[model samples]
Target: MRHFNHLLQRLRKIVAVALLSATTAALAGIAPAHADWLKAESERFIVYSDGNEGKLREFVQELEGFDRLLRLRMGLTVEEAPPRKLPIYLVGSRRGLLQVSPDLAENIAGFYMATDEDIFGIALRDQTVNTLKHEYAHHFMMQNFAYPYPGWFVEGFAEYYATVEIEKSRILVGKYNQNRAYWLQAASWMPMTELLSKRPLQTARNRDSYYPLAWLLTHWFVGDPDRQKLLSAYLRDVGEGGDPVEAMQRATGLSPTELSRTLRRYMRGPMPYQIMTLSFPQPPVTVTRLPRSANDLLLLNQRLKVGVPDDRRPATAEEVRRAAARHPDDPLALLALGHAELHFGDAAAAEAPLQRLLAMEPDHVEALQYLVRARMEAARDAESPEEAERLENEARALLHRAYRADDANYATLLLIAENRAGGAGSPNDNDVTVLEQAFTLAPQLGSARINLAQVLMFKDRNAEAIALLEPLVNDPHRPSSGAREMLLRAKGMSEAEADAEEAEILRQGEAEDEADGEEPPTGN
Candidate 1:
């Protein structure tokens, strides 16, 4: 119902073009003749998928930076043979997870902690850095030593190390993400014993609590002297194949059971908290006409936005409630309330309003989408495993409904494809089907096209992929840098040749682009 504001419109245009050019170029490139490694200097691995040169370079840099930071913080030495490399997939949309695991990707922006090997993906660039850091922690831990470390410690330590503090803001990466504000919020203390004993599947199901619990436990161990020493000892003992329970008893002079209780008490006690916020301000609200006879819905969406803005003071909540009551059946009102609750860190509070709206208007696509998100948020506060699992399932169902309602929603489709690709596969029939489906839906959605090309490349169908990208590379309207790089790659030209071509093209285009003073077409 919201109108497309200038900012959103601008972003959409930029992202669309950027994505198109990037994918087009990727598919245009031919396999290199040299045996030289393809990865950026910083990363231990290189990804050939999605043919987006700019993105690939960025990924390599970030991974390298993360590795450097970890080496400094944890006193790790990058091994010459860095175990097996993890293939990191960066998708342009959040809902693209659905194309992978119909249920798991519905609510989360990124995913890891899977049973199968070779499955990892991160969506949304802002979240990508942290997610990569967090997953890398897991990869490092698993590879460095055979420590049967408790889940709490494994995930907790990862959270502590993954945190990125910049200037006035601090972000909790994985297992425990800060509140929507990026501010630390108090959680119902979960017992350490409970954290350790829970299986990964259980943890996955009750991610709301488990995520934070991992963070809190890690925070305690790293910040507190006694706990920190004991954790170090625990890792050492576990690495030696000693009984961790006995090791805990010896190291801390507390039995595993006692230590667990102490951890529960520690978690229950308050720890230092910080507020986390985004670099970007909240997106502007725009009103658009509703389809068919949903004019009332348009008005409803506007009033809801009026009720809440970036600075969510108490007065706004009261105003929101008042507006909601005025239009009980309004889909947008319920959607806004759901978003507000999510932002406020009260997932439980959001679920009812969103659910009610869905019940009243099953076809409300936005409402259905948010309803799924609301349930996932509520899952954090679920009192029991069954309840948490139920909420997660419910959320996934709602998301699937939204995705099915409009298969062409490129954002959702991208997430789905990325999620699926993260899991291990050899570009099987199913993967080919999904990738083709995604490519068909939005030819200009460069991310998907690139992903398809990557899959095709892996299948040794490089010629086919190159054909897909060649036209975009030659297109004068394509973003220059991305297109030139992709064109070179598709043609199997040497790097020097490619760079020369790119430089010449840039020299000719710089004047025009500067005169336009618009952002270079971005394929976000």
Candidate 2:
């Protein structure tokens, strides 16, 4: 019996070791066969290649930076995983526009957009960075915020920021949205009350008019009237403690719903007179190429990937220090060193390399964001709340800089607007107003539509949700299967009925799967 107990103990010890090994491997990202890329060096960004990997890596980096900045700004440092790897493909020849996804289209020079799991796809080199920035904003907001924001503010802000000034050209970071002109051509202004209460679908169908109106309206808040006063009042009402709708009523002499109607009526044109003129000098040169290369720097990266377990990975801070020394100018290598130090839970070590990356690229959003987080994380580790708060302020300031860089990034705007809705601490008309704006910007985005539908449904508007879902079910080309399924499930079908239908489909699918030797998906 003593011998038997000894054997059992030995088995348990072996199992524990194996489990620990597995966990470590997983955390180190060793399981993904394609995660490793050939490292290279370039001026704009440290190039990593799995063939066109630079674009995706830069995208991820910028996104990471944006998030870190926001967290630093907001004083909320939630742990997050590295963003899923997004693959970018370069077109040797323009075969029309590459169909990046079901919903997005892009030319070789412009960019294409699509998402799978956490992996986002960008087709163009130039647009990849901006698109990543925009999408990451969406991902961060959805993950962190408690509630959804309004449509106008969401899309308007996205549009404002999505405009990228590259060389002499304005690259639209969001959609081209040619329709903004139509809204500009629409009649005079609407009351705030009516505008806030408008439905998303209704707004989308008139997006040409809606987009511009939203831009103008947002411009009004951000640029027009007594800019500071209007913003202070509006933000206070929505972000602090005032009612958004009531604030509008007080400020503009119209209720939120009434403002919606007035905007519609005012949608025709000119807004009586030019409220503001946004003018700027163009860049002297067109940004020719967003380059990607790093042969010498990547040698370490390749070794890290394929070398034996003990032989691979920098074993000490000194090794990381040495490797980073060899590739002094490579941001990725520096970031890797920083990431390694951060992994050891040393904020100071992490901050050093991250700050190095920032010095090279001031607008490096990902580094800025993560550096902020690391700084705060380090401060927190050092048990200094005041330092963390200062770091938070710096981070938020960085986001504002990114935000100010381009105001058209609807996704970022949506994040802020949504925050305002929930952060205001009360249910009022502002939430509805903001959501309506978001609906216009991303009409095809199911999440925003769902937000609208849910609000209506909560107000006992099941018919409205059904109404919204009905057109989408037959879309045949819905971007998300999940969204479609939700629509079907929301159609008031009994479980037994759905089960019966599913069983028939499953039986058919099984026969098909058997013939093909493939299994069907279990929809969760």
Per-residue alpha-carbon lDDT of candidate 2 for residues 438-504, written as tens digits (9 for 90 to 100): 5544444455666666655555666556545433332312323454455555666665774565344
Q: Taking the tens digit of each residue's C-alpha lDDT, what string does model 1 give over 408-507?
A: 4444554445434444664676777777765554443345556777777678786666644543342211323453355456557777975564354334
- The prediction achieving the highest lDDT against the true structure is 1
Worst-scoring 10-residue span by lDDT in model 1: 280-289
lDDT of each: 0.51, 0.45
What are the per-model C-alpha RMSD values against the true structure? 27.6, 22.5
Clashes of 1: 25
Worst 10 residues of 2 by lDDT: 282-291
TM-score of 2: 0.34
**Model 1 misplacement above 4 A:** 1-42, 47-56, 72-75, 79-83, 113-120, 165-177, 180-187, 197-208, 224-227, 237-249, 253-524
Give residue 501's lDDT in candidate 2 (0 to 100). 50
